[model samples]
Target chain A: MRNPLTEAFGIEYPIFAFSHCRDVVAAVTNAGGMGVLGALAFSPEELEQELTWIDEHVGGRPYGVDVVMPVKTLDRDAGIDDVSDIGAQLRSHISQDHWDYTDRILTEHGVDVAARDDGLEEGAGLGAGVLGWTAATGAPQIDIALSHDIALLASALGPPPKAAIDQAHEQGVKVAALIGRVEQAQRDVALGVDIIIAQGYEAGGHTGEVASMVLVPDVVDAVDVPVLAAGGIGGGRQMAAAMALGAAGVWTGSIWLTVAENGSSPVVTEKLLGATSTDTVRSRAYTGKPARQLRTAWTDAWEAPDSPGTLPMPLQFILNSYASQKMGATPPRELVGMPVGQIVSRMDQVRSTKQVVVDMVQEYVDVTERLTADLEG
Target chain B: MRNPLTEAFGIEYPIFAFSHCRDVVAAVTNAGGMGVLGALAFSPEELEQELTWIDEHVGGRPYGVDVVMPVKTLDRDAGIDDVSDIGAQLRSHISQDHWDYTDRILTEHGVDVAARDDGLEEGAGLGAGVLGWTAATGAPQIDIALSHDIALLASALGPPPKAAIDQAHEQGVKVAALIGRVEQAQRDVALGVDIIIAQGYEAGGHTGEVASMVLVPDVVDAVDVPVLAAGGIGGGRQMAAAMALGAAGVWTGSIWLTVAENGSSPVVTEKLLGATSTDTVRSRAYTGKPARQLRTAWTDAWEAPDSPGTLPMPLQFILNSYASQKMGATPPRELVGMPVGQIVSRMDQVRSTKQVVVDMVQEYVDVTERLTADLEG
Candidate 1:
């Protein structure tokens, strides 16, 4: 229970929970583990609201905010300065063929793509394209996060921009970057990032080819900073494995999706609960980069022979956002899926976020005790 | 240093070394770890010679033999009985287009495709198509293995055929199967296999999507038999992590490639020594199934847009064997690659097999002691 991460963060355990829901974040933080709220789905104002809610609910316990600041996004090359125009600018990059292919697949799946705008206004819901992935959009979210009483700032893709890292440092917020490669860990540490989350291929969102068993130790060896193990880690035994691999702590994502406070759609929750590890796949269909998600008709269509391939980065998300919106309205159970890890197999039951944290700590303790016993006897 | 695996196998350490070289196997066995010789590349006569050499060298120390008896193969559906005719029969099933594509890639790479038959006869060398993958080919290898003094018989793909399991058990040889998924592990154990090697996506050769960090504990939980953690495990820390995740031992492959006794070509050994974890990729280019190998120009060509997609199972291997043959005569340093895992990053030096085993055990002891201290203090 006590490690560099626990001692540094002043937490009861070294479990870091990443979730988009404010309730899950607050619940995990209140339960003595650090809860990191994902800021990708929310606008800057919405992120501020979420952080304010978490701040009030957690009663001043330390929590973190995770933002997607990818180094190789379309907007990086497009040179869009205005944050307001960023979404429209990125959307224009999506080819007509890609848009038509997505629509055709959705229509074939019985999703009413034509009737997608029946009730919801354009860019109203979670399907809003290019939601805070680029520097133009993510910078404001980082600014909003620093204004709050946040303990950590995590970049989901690449190194948080130098300016953002320096700003977080000025605010006494530790900056962490999620990297799948060892070289990326070195680069992130050089950029003044405090912690490196070595995410493996089994992780939920965007991931690298290396697995935690290899990447954790590789990152731990390459960097002077503390490295948090991410991807495919759900419970205490996995946490113990991460620690054994020299990780400071475990950064978990998918396990939180099915928790009682998760606020995920019941349909997605059911699918996650029923899924085995094999049910998930690393597909570029949604994110343009390989992101582990529940394999569905939607992913399959994009991978099919005749269908046009997915667009890159922000463009893919923009194009797929329409299908997501349509599916959200009609709820094509088969086409509906979420980014999840191979650990989805273990998220079988719905428990409180606090209960999940407690179980993980208990199991970690049990595993360590067993390992210690093995050493002596 | 002792666990259920060490006790069960009567070995000083629970480290399982897998290599195609008999010298590496014997050296590892004599060094107090169990070395399992990969029987895929050897004919029954060749395997007999290798095991005889190992028996002579190890002086009755415990060792194992690994075979590839995939439950699903082209031969399984093709109904080929004669082992000698199996190659020609399977070769015929490969499309002419695939043959041309493979030749074209090799020819474009400055390889002398026409001069392939200059020094090597067809089906004379390692590039011989369909090497002990199917039941017909692999069953003989298993028989040859059981005839030897191997302490363990390991099937690299599916569960060892029921007959092979019974045969090995009758001879007091433990049967182990390598699996990537939990369901596969369950199937393996249900088939009366003594041990399950839960290989993750980070492993060399054929692997499943699940990673060792996730797959190890998942398999350990699913089966009654003791599980050996494989893929991406090279050093002592990875072994400790695997044990922490509930594995009885660690089964390693990539690390042994660079050992002094490995007998790999100097070109491949040099590539492995210099390669980082990211340098290896899982591609079905060489094998019909996805196998992790060094990302050379050869693998890149298979992944290129102009190249035809790889064929399935034995057919792909059959087609690529020609390119492999041509490359063998005139070594293309950029085109030459071998099956390797992410742990290839750690194989930066040429240590003796004994030294590698000693170092791993020392590291395991150090890690366990550190964990114990962490718990106490």
Candidate 2:
């Protein structure tokens, strides 16, 4: 029961559940393993409210905050209030045909349209310009996290900037970065990252070029620090494999997205359940990064011949966010592709987050036992 | 150039260039990249003769022989020369319909028919059991190699058996094993394999479940021995990436398969030249192992609904060798899926093996210089 990773984090289990919902984070942390709230979708004030709620609900249990401080963002200086200017730039980047196609699709889906703001086509339903592109958006969110009882700060994108790392270290908070390459692992180590997450392309959400089964050891070798295997890791078998491959722990995301305590839309959960190993792709259509998502009709449309290729970072994200939300809210919802990985195939049923963590540990124990027995035999 | 790999082997270059042709082995060893003669198709006596000729031509530059020593052979104890017996067992394992379909396809393709040794089925060309299928087949070839000044014993399958490793070490020859997983690297270490070849599934021939980009570091982490990155590595950029990922060197197969020094069938060489990155598939149809080969009509046929699923290990290999041979001899080469990796896309034309190695090293230097400039800037 004494997970090395949990020991490292001073938590009950190595399970660091990544979630967008404050309720899920609070529930997971209270259940023992750390719940790391995803701060990419939230504004500074919204993140503050969520962190406060988690601080109250977590009952003094340790938790973490995840921010998207990608090393490469389209517009690093865009702020929330002044996003309209960059939003205008993004509008110019999008073509009229693309706009018409999006409108037609939303109308065909019977989505209730909000009245368009006349003065600015830039800051429409989506947030203003390049503000959504960079980690600056997460700066205030990081401040909110620092104010809470957060034990760790993880960057979902590239390594957190040197300043961010310094600030986190100053606060006595552990810093971790998700990476897909050995070079990135070395860079993270040089950047003084406490943990290197070698996430494979098989993982849900934004991912890099490598697969988890191969990336973990590469990262472990490139960095002296401990590595948590992410991507394609969902069950005990993968966890055992990761450990066998020299990972300190396994960091999973998709396995929790459809759990009983997950905040994922019901339609999205259903789609995830129906997906197989091949039912996902790395696309920048949803976010302006290579994210592994369920290969849905929406993803297919983005890949189709006629549609303009996806816009870069904030521009693409802004153009698609409202339509994505509407699609997430619909039935026969093949259009909306939720970020999931190859592990989606194993997410057959919904279970409580606590049960999921417990089962993973139990499964790990069983696998080791079986392997040992086989080796001895 | 003082290539470390060749120096390690007391050869010209570190490159252990794999080729089915004896002429290529002599040429590469003479030029630089130590040509490793593919002994799969050659009889023990023929292999000996080939090695003798290479020794005569390369002026003792340390050429080696490569044989298929698949771990999962048809019957582990089935003597390599017990062609009729093994063929009977292999045929029995496959259904009558499968055999009939195989026959029909071959006959349709204008393949010449010959009465099989057992006369159980009249199939096209010769029986398949004569080709390399087990360690038994490769053992004689190894013996032939040892009779020469061969410095390295490389296994195309899983880690060579303890006896093979011991035998090679006893002879002052290094034993190398190709691994696609971290656990396999550990297994190779426990088996006392002197070299761990972390070949990604993207590599040609029998590969495991991980890609090279991930496998190299994982292998490096799992073993103390020098690690070589195989799969998806063809040119200088990939070579740099492999070293960046902690590999001591690159073990390339596809790159050599197209070199002018390589005497690959003109048909096969052309296919490799024109192919793109997307033209390869990891299918078990060719060698009873998950090998990356050109996505050809033969591969399509093997995966079709009416076709029988491939048999396991040596049996599947026994059932397909004649077909492979016929494919090799044909024009426009239908049913001929040349074993290759994702790196095949980068192979645009045939060049001398030595020049290829030199270019790769030079390109690696250039790429590093560009990267360093970017870093400093």
lDDT of 1 by residue, A1-377 (tens): 57778888888877899998999999999999999999888877788889989989998889999988888877788887686666567667767888788778888878776665764344622242376766666778888899999999998788778998999999889999999888888888988999999999999989888888888998999999999999889988898888888888889999999988878877888999999888988889877889999999988988898977877787777666767667764478888889999998898999999899989988887888888777675
Error of 1 at B283 (Å): 1.2
- Cα lDDT, all candidates: 0.84, 0.68
**Using TM-score as the measure, which candidate wins?**
1
Measured over the true interface residues after superposition, the C-alpha RMSD of each candidate is 1.4, 14.8
lDDT score, candidate 1, position A189? 91
Q: Which 10-residue span in candidate 1 chain B carries the lowest summed lDDT?
A: B120-129
Indicate which candidate wins on lDDT: 1
For B1-377, candidate 2 gives per-residue lDDT tens digits of 34335457765434556777777677766776667777777777777787777778888677666666666665674444564444554555566676666666677676653423333354422232334555545566777777787877777776666776787888888877777667777877888987787877667777664555445655676689888777766666566556555566667777888877666777777789998655777888876677878998777878886777877776556557645544344533676678887667678888877778788767655644543332233
Interface DockQ of each model: 0.72, 0.04
Tell me model 2's lDDT, rounded to 2 decimals: 0.68
Task: Compute fnat per model.
Answer: 0.69, 0.01
lDDT, residue A158, candidate 2: 75
